[model samples]
Target: MIKKPLFPYNPKYPSVADLKRRAKWRIPKFAFDYLQGGCNEELNLERNESDFDNIYLKPHYLKTGGEIDMSVELFGRTYSAPFGISPIGLQGLMWPNAPEILAKAAAKHDIPYTLSTVSTSSIERIAEVSDGKAWFQLYHPTEDRLRDDILNRLKSVSCPVLVVLIDVPSFGLRYREIKSGLSMPPKMNIENIFQAMICPEWGIKTLQHGIPSFATLKPYMEKGLDLSQLGQFMNKTFTGKVNMEKVKAIRDLWPGPLVLKGVASEEDMEGAISLGVDGVIISNHGGRQIDAGESSLISLIKLANNPKYTGKVKIMMDGGIRSGVDLGRAHAVGSEFNFMGRPFMYGVGALGDEGADHTINMFKAQLYQVMQQLTLEKVSDFPTRLIR
Candidate 1:
């Protein structure tokens, strides 16, 4: 018999699609658009999920199964699950106290929860909430002083893994964000105000939490700046690109395991290995940075097939993963570990404080069910069940 998850799982929102539908109805349109939309017609975004359909897993029904251990050891820590919550900017905008809620849940579950450079909750706060198990992703800054300062802060909190973002040389042309006035210096037009008015619960929570600002970057920002000035400051602070020189500089300073995010090709994977990066998360900024790019799964398969780079560095992925079966598929294909952004955000948006716990629990239950049927005993054993 399968074990029941202790976390509350609402039957009405068993699937991520149900949570997304409820989230759309709960939050303001602008917030939901920012959380869901991708760049340049979202072709890459569509491909991310659709591509998973091509992969299949083989189940061994006759084989007797022992214990199923979903725990995975990454960068010296043993997590309760192989998957984690991918960092998202402005999490509080989706639901007030979103980062704190997720961080607390992640701590309780022994899963990694990454805190973004621009997330609403501060580094120290998430460090406290996650019991220092949270990973931090840095959005490369223009100035060496700012970069060094952020690194020093991460060191202070003893962040286990430092993930430096390599994508976003330029922001994507997201039609929904553009039309919704969610662009930098995000404008709250009459329409947005009306939408907020309709969502009284969200509005009340926002009122209690205050408007979502970059809590991590607050110390560096000037006080009493208006929205336009805030946008200008942000544009001037982050360089939006990470070059070899930047990587070298960071490698020299950060003492812990360093992972590169937004890597999508063999060449980049080789470069990350050369730079002594402990791991590379095969991502296209969640299909938000480039629409012409291939899905993250495609990138992972390419790297997995190349034995030249295997075992040299950890290869992980994060795109279009919405279900436990999807998680199984990605792991079987070549990804050592996985992460997801929208599903967790949708969870928080749908159920508020209870959302993060519910989503993590659901993923655990779903993955366990799949593994039990496959007669898979370990997360690393997922590759054996692959049809390839």
Candidate 2:
């Protein structure tokens, strides 16, 4: 008989890497690469996690340890922790109805779960699962009509926060994806067949459900690549319309806290501040869009320390965090909150609905261990315990 996971859940769960391995073994090569692979050569991708490993820690064992308060307050709302599930498009491709699983898991834990503009599930579906704590990530469709409709859809779901992804003003050129035949909802061709055949578990689940599609996009377009082509057409069809004015218009409509993701430049940061946004997530789209840009960690450190950024707005970071040490290093340097795109998705891919819960437990476990050694308590203490 299969064992039951701990009741009310337990933080001392499996490792995120374990989930990654399980996900890899469960999905086709195309799907696995979509979760794991990054841009050309993936040097930046490897560097993102390895950079965290390079940072050292100094323990203070003699200090009287206290309670670990993981709760955080950001943009006038309190969260259970400083980390959240970052958005990924078409999550159902990894697991059947993945967005719902992520949203439900995040809600059960009282954390934020961001919904991608391209998610397989609708915003309203997330609202039902996440109880309106869901955050919406906007990609800024090129057409005003389409964009407004999307925003209205998010509002209908009663989402509390809006995170606009600006890093992908245009999609990045990812060589690994190209080599892997990575497509949204994926293309089930002769090549993908061999890939599925290799992963019997993934293939069986996929066959049972008839393969994941861009369910949200299906109503707008026909089946298979035809629908995908329509989405691509819409993207190219409206690229020129997504500008500062477009962003401002969105700001005017959405009355909740607005944060901008993919912010990499001082001017962009300044622009977000000018727009009167609530916060900014310093990210390089998880090193997904650009090849030469600095990691969000370096960018966050610079932006947070800058006199201009002092209390002007909240500063957060993504793109390199893998463990509590990484999250601690980022907080020590300057970042306040963080988001992880692939890791959480990997959880869902690895174990279907249970993936997000397992991944969150694993990360919490890693963080707890880090705290045990550092003689620290509470996530807030991370900023003060910095060491070279």
Candidate 3:
């Protein structure tokens, strides 16, 4: 007999497919494509999941297996779950006031919610929503004063962790973005206007709320432009001087856990280790940076095997993590912290505030199924129970 499904919404609420569908409908086309699409060829995007699929789980039937603890501590604080919301910028453009909605949901669930420095919501705004259960992602500025002021504000709000996104030396080559002609302040063209008009729900909501822009940068920016304008400012503001000295300087001023994101090589990992870093996430900026770049998982294998860095510094990762099993595989490969960037954003974009909880619960369900099938009692056992 065919078995019945566990969830009511789409048989299992918040599945990756369901979440994707919802996000697509709620967000404008160009905005959705940027979040969902990868660079040219998307080789790494596919590899991110195929790498996990290539690894299987070895069941331990005799081991205890009940009441699995999903809680984890990372960067000096304990989180209710092993996963946290990854940073996404221009969230307001995707869905109005999206940062607050996601932040509130993350807070309610006791998970970490990170806000990008370029996000439309202010740090204080998300702090209010998430009760400061927030981390900040800095795309380092060229102006020292601008960087200092940004850091000072984060300190004032007491954001616990500061993430430095270094992979994006230049923005990833996003083709869909080029075709859509959908830039910020959304310059309406015949094609875009027609498309926007086609999606009445999204269009009406956007009209009522007004188009979302960089609210955080409003104080700093006087002149605005569409996608090209935003891109130029991004190029100007997010400078290329992200080096060890800069990180050391940031460390001196900020007392929170300092994470160096987009470390793809062991050399970079070692550099991060030597710099008084608290954590280094092996990533390719979720396949959004380079078209031909290697998958973060494959890169993770090389970095995690080096005994010099093992257990000395916390390792985190994110890319093509669409299920709980994927999370299991990432940890098994030596990552202690796992961040999912698109899933939670897609969730909130799909169903507003409820998206956060629904997506988390969806992962909980999938993770539980994987754990029980493997007959495992705890997450720490994953390294041994892993099958190649």
Candidate 4:
């Protein structure tokens, strides 16, 4: 007999916007700003979402279809959905134990969970929670020894994929973060303290979990370093710029699937291919890197349509993707897989532990609904439904 499926999502928070609203109220202002704010005027950030509105999908009312299949395969493994949680740094500041909570949810949902090198949760801890299914995103360290050590640790935990970030040559100047004193290692002034007081839930959870730190980098960091010292260490340790030499060096070192995040042009894609990288994530650091950068959608459209770059390497995208319809649009365009950072964090911030599962379920349900409406049975058919 066919068994019935369980509905796990909260109907009240059916959309990412709903989660965002609830999350904003539950977390401190500084935390909310860090999660939501983009760099400079945030024009690129606004465009990232608005650009999706231009993409139209055609539905076939008379087409025959059975059950909708949302399953997707990437890097030799199948996932419940095409999208996964993108890596985010300082996740605990958004909500206590945010990385662990999302990692558990991703594993439960059979979706990929990427852990940032600078996140609050340690690599081993996340790997343990995700049962070693989690992916690791590395920010190339200034020291080769440090890089090798981190890679070895990830290998020890049996990480399946290694994502190298290439966007932050120099960190973007986010006005909100600067204004709120939410820099690296973060400053806890009187205003920040008051903001924390207003969000009692976040405060209590933070107290329980303790202050968020750079968990992955803890081994390299000196003990008892203050915020100022930590900032100095961070600056001294991570060089933002990534050249072809750096990519090639990492390519030589890492044996697993090597993916380059922050690819926005065919030139960058070509560079990734030339260096023997396995995949490229077409992102603009969620519009936190360049204020004038093209949206990831535009880049996907350009590269996916180009025969030169289409089949050479795996192409994925992440930036301003907030809904199931957006996912469908992305697939219709060119993204083989998709990822979102703030959405999952927003999920954790909204409902704490339950938020991750709820958010994943919501995306699955919405994507399924869109597929059903279009009379498309498989995710691969989404391209055909694109109204060009």
How accurate locally is residue 109 in candidate 3, as Cα lDDT from 0 to 100? Answer: 75
Q: Could you tell me every candidate's TM-score relative to the true structure?
A: 0.98, 0.90, 0.92, 0.98
Q: Is candidate 1 or candidate 3 better by TM-score?
A: 1
Lowest lDDT 10-residue stretch of candidate 2: 5-14
Q: Give the per-residue lDDT digits (tens) of candidate 4, residues 38-87.
A: 99999999999999999999999998899877889888999989999999
Candidate 1, residue 372: lDDT:
88
Clashing pairs in 2: 69-378, 142-238, 347-355
Lowest lDDT 10-residue stretch of candidate 1: 2-11
Tell me the lDDT of candidate 2. Answer: 0.76
Clashes of 2: 3
Worst 10 residues of 4 by lDDT: 2-11
Question: lDDT per prediction?
Answer: 0.92, 0.76, 0.78, 0.92
Candidate RMSDs in order: 1.4, 3.3, 3.0, 1.6
Tens digits of lDDT, candidate 1, 1-388: 9876544598888999999999998999999999999998899999999999999999999999999999999998889999999999999998899999999999999998999998999999999999998999999999999999999999999999999999878888899999999998899999999999999999999999999999999889999999999999989998467888899889999999999999998778888999998999999888898889999999889987798987999889999999999999999998889999999999999999999989999999899999988999999998899997
lDDT per residue as tens, model 2, 215-331: 544455545556467557656643552457877998998888889887878999999999998899988877777667777777787798799888888888888787766877777
Off by over 4 Å in 4: 1-7
Name the lDDT value of residue 136 in candidate 4: 94
